[model samples]
Target: GGTIHIGYFDQHSENLLDAMNESQRVIDYIKDVAEYVETADGTQISASQMLEKFLFPGNQQYAPVYKLSGGEKRRLFLLKVLMSAPNVLILDEPTNDLDVQTLAVLEEYLEEFNGCVIVVSHDRYFLDRTVDRIFAFEGVGNLRQYPGNYSLYIDYKEVEAATKKAVAVAEKSKETSVKPKKSERVSWDKNKQRKLSSKEKREYENLEKKITQLEAEKAKTENELYNAPPGEVSEVQKLHEKVESLEKEIDTATERWLELAEINS
Candidate 1:
């Protein structure tokens, strides 16, 4: 989850291939090359079980580590990290070169894992599954905390942006003043009070309903994308496009709703 599982993120550590060069079978590689340690929860894992889980069974188990595919090596390395049982897992870009099956397995493992996971990733699907809270970097050393999954956080951000735009428009409207004509040399004050007309009230209600529907559609799309199999690239891409389109619709509807709401207030 989060592009990397707990204890699965170091890219440039002592090479996995180096360990491969020293070991024979996958089990031997794990037992002899990788560090074996107990988990923070005091759970101990068997090397054979780990080998079977991380790598394929039968011929692949007995195959030399050097003969394993790139994805296999990465998977094995991830198992090694998990075996170490670190209390805190800090990962950076763990999704590169990983197979979909492996990702599914890793996601399952993370779901069951009991440890602190610190992940820095742009994988929205992963973040949605893994993190309950997000610390979003807003540039220039600013960080904003949101108490929800990525999809909800994005919704919050969109609403916040719309609110800001509405406020700006409202403020700008107040800045306008009637310029006194040079010939008249005088001007009359006009009341700036605004209220929703009967027609406008209906429009406001309709806009609010449209905004709610768009938000629900976006959330549904996000959920579908998150649960979608990684192998279905085209389907995932389509869902992403749907989410983006819905966001735009929501933003526009929200802006109109805000304008009406402010006037009615």
Candidate 2:
């Protein structure tokens, strides 16, 4: 029954990107925090049970899944997964080749899944919408598990990484401000310690202040949502569509901190 769940590229030609994109869409829909799910009868459904009851109902097989443009293919692939009828789904990178419209459809289905879902994606915007938690791949051995969805993950991740970066900067400045730990006896150990002038001292203080303020601001924003209505309609619903914009601020700050770290290094 799941085999009828056709996931194919719309532009089924030599366009490797589209093909890969189609595959990713299907995979991402299966992740642990997914909102969509498959049932015992092999029926794909959402919280509203709209896919089988409406969108692709009445034996309405997917046309775009067989052949279409990159954008169209992505839509079909997502629909297929939404209807695959599984108890648990895992999706990885489901946004490739999707236009804003198709992405919306996929996001809606995800916002609709009910079972355990796990998704692997780098699309911050998509992640912010569809996921409840994040298993972000940081490096070869580091995959940070964030409590909230991607947006929250980004916020928390930035705090974690930025705080580390800010700490590094503070340490470097502290080191530069210190007189070389009483010059060593050996001539080879007599490396000169760079001294911070008065201006540098003031600048360092300003940086510290700015970092402290940013930390407080981030905390305020996060806490604000807790008291402000978390939305009675749905779990994935409260996060307004403007989440992408909100995340941008954090991203910008993270980048700045990273840049400062580079300068200090």
Candidate 3:
């Protein structure tokens, strides 16, 4: 009944407002409960009729791109995706820019969809809702499959990675202690990575969790900032600084995690 594009954040392109034809198709379908809509097709909906009372719930109201709040723009783009009825949805980290309400709307819709849904997300909350299987890119140029939601997959994956890494480290220790042949390379390799050890695995998991929490907190702060009184210069300035700090934290955490992951790859 709907098309869901879950992929790298903002993959929906800026032309969303121009996809009028497809947008109309979606409007006609959801007409039973439709309140408002953005860019879709013209056949199914006129721009004037696109107005919806159901625009994103709470303070995170949906608006046209130029008029939208940051959160609203995020949801509007997602709404645009649903306008194109796709039988098989492709998602890449769909949770990245979503607010909780928007995320819930998507989760509800995807759960009711009749076709297959492939979600690529690092958000545990999202994966637990829409995915029943996990296709994880395990460390060290490996891909592994697990039959469970994100939480289970995380647990299983960390253990597997640790087992592999520890074994590799242990093997290196043995080679050095026993004195391997001169032709043999150093026991450790700058590029060679084993599975993560228990300690390392736990640390990685904690980092991931912290990132998720921080993102949520940052979103909440943004919502508050938008809802603050108009022309509240001091409050706006404070929020801007906080947002800047959050951005830095996000960049730092993401870089470190990728660095650790690349070691195994």
TM-score per prediction, in order, is 0.60, 0.43, 0.41
Q: Write the per-residue lDDT of candidate 2 for residues 1-265, one digit (tens) a residue.
A: 5533333333332344344433343223333225565644556545334443323432433332333455544454455445555446666565545667666766665565555566666778877677665566777989654445566555555555655675576567545743334453343232222344576556655665666676666566546443333222233333332333444554555555443433344
- Compared with the true structure, all predictions reach lDDT values of 0.67, 0.50, 0.56
lDDT comparison, 1 vs 2, better candidate: 1
For TM-score, the strongest prediction is 1
Candidate 1, residue 217: how far the Cα is off, in Å = 27
What are the runs in model 3 whose C-alpha is more than 4 Å off? Answer: 1-66, 139-141, 158-265
Worst 10 residues of 3 by lDDT: 56-65
In every candidate, how many clashes are there? 0, 28, 24
Error of 3 at 124 (Å): 1.6
TM-score of decoy 2: 0.43
Tens-place lDDT digits, model 1, residues 154-203: 86577557656755764564456335466534322121265678999999
Ordered from best to worst TM-score, the candidate numbers read 1, 2, 3
**Candidate 2 accuracy as lDDT:** 0.50
